[model samples]
Target: MQTSLAKSVTFNGVGLHSGAPVRMRLHPADADHGIVFRRIDVIGMQNRVHATWDRVTPSKLCTLIENEDGVTVSTIEHITAALAGCGVHNALIEIDGPEVPIMDGSSAPFVAGIRRSGIRFLRAPLRAIRILKPVEFKDGVATARLEPADGFEIDFAIDFTDAAIGQQSKRLEMANGAFVRELMECRTFCRQADVDHMQAHGLALGGTYENAIVFDGDKVLSPGGLRRPDEAVRHKMLDALGDLSLAGAPILGRYVGNRAGHAMTNRLLRALFAQPDAFEYVTLDADQERLLPGAGVCRPVALAG
Candidate 1:
């Protein structure tokens, strides 16, 4: 069955990139509505942006979507990931700003809010995209690909110059609440040098040790140390789940990423759709639906250890 939030849930925080205070609300939508973002801040014009690959706009750090009127919202990957992980088929995300709140730089807050609001089943059936052939995208050394699989899976690998995050790899079948229990709370991270570079260029004004895990050489600058030894890679997998959500439905395939970022994943989607023979839409059978992430998920657990 298709699902959505039982009611509206509100979130207030600063945007990670814009650093501006914003208020966003997630409201349940009718079946087939998909996920649409509304820029309530827009005046006297159309302000609806669909959370899909076709609506995506190029951004260096995060996933961004825009409508024809140029109404855009940035940094939506986390919440989008949460929605997909929770098996929410449709929602209307209303934000009175140009970006979604960053919250704690993880999808946990969104997941918790959604759990509190609860889940509502829709009368319509759920559909998913099936990979009929492999599609790969490469950007220099970074790469992402999608290949046929019985269920959704993610295989990710990352290598960083910082000894603190030298090399990490992880793979998971994103089903049976694995996304919620394992990947949901992993926070976005960056090297201290990169943070300094961003700040030098007048960016990441709202970033702090609390929201993002910062690494400097071999030391973790964040006061809390590490949530998990392999958190950096877990966060990458978390990000992959969120980025893949832009496909507009659950995907029955294996996603593999190597040092990939938001842009590369978006480009991978473009490649998938470009080759019409690469994928096809189908309504998932009960067994197939049970294999998708959040198929049996309910509420989120505690984020604090």
Candidate 2:
């Protein structure tokens, strides 16, 4: 069955890039509402930004969505991923700024909020996107592809020259609350050089060692340490799930990403839509529905990673 949040939940924090404090809330919506962002700060314009592939604007650092009126919400990947992680399909996300708060640089905080507010199943049947054929997109060496699969899964690989974060690969079958248990708490990571560069360009102004894993070659610079052994790769898979949720429906496919980020994932969605025969919308069978990302995710406990 489709579901929505049982009650509204609120969050307040500073934007990672903008460095401006913001507030956001998630309100339960009707069955087919999908996920839509409302800019409460916009006085007299169409403030609704549908979390859909067509609305995505190009950005490497984060997943951004813009409406026809040019209203936008930046850094939505974590929230979107949290929604997917909880299996909450229809939500009206209200925000008071142009960007969502970058809470802890991971979906853990959002996951905690959603679990606390709980979920209410709707009466409507669920719909999902089932890949009929493989669709691939590439930019330089980075690539993203989706192929037919009975259940949702992610296989990702990342390679960095920095010794601290060299080549890492992971394959996850996102079933039975695998997202919450295996991927939710992994924080975003960046090299010290990248942080220096982003700060020089007036970006990552809100970034701190507290929120992200800052690593130098062969060294972890963040205060504590990694939440898990391969946190970087797990976080990439988490990001992929969030970006894929923007397709406006659950996808039953094997997503393979090789050093791919937000832009490449968005482009992959565009390519999927461009090819009519590559995918199809379907009402899932009992077995298939049970094999999706948020299966049995009723309570967001301290799941083992």
User: Worst ten-residue run, lDDT, model 2?
Assistant: 296-305
Q: Each model's TM-score, in the order given?
A: 0.96, 0.96
Question: After superposition on all CA atoms, what RMSD does each candidate show versus the true structure?
Answer: 4.0, 3.7
The residue pairs that clash in candidate 1, if any, are none
Error of 1 at 277 (Å): 0.9
For 1-305, candidate 2 gives per-residue lDDT tens digits of 78888889999998999889999999988888899999999988899999988999988789999998999999999999999988989899999999899889999999999999888877788999999999999989999999999999999999988787899999999999999999999998899999999999999998999889999999999887888979999999999999999998999999999999999999999999999999999997678878988777865222111
Candidate lDDT scores, in order, read 0.90, 0.91
Residue 179 displacement (Å), model 2:
0.3
Q: Stretches of candidate 1 above 4 Å error?
A: 299-305
Q: How do the residues 28-107 of candidate 1 rate in per-residue lDDT, one tens digit apiece?
A: 88888999999988998899999999999999988989889888988899999999988887899999998888888889
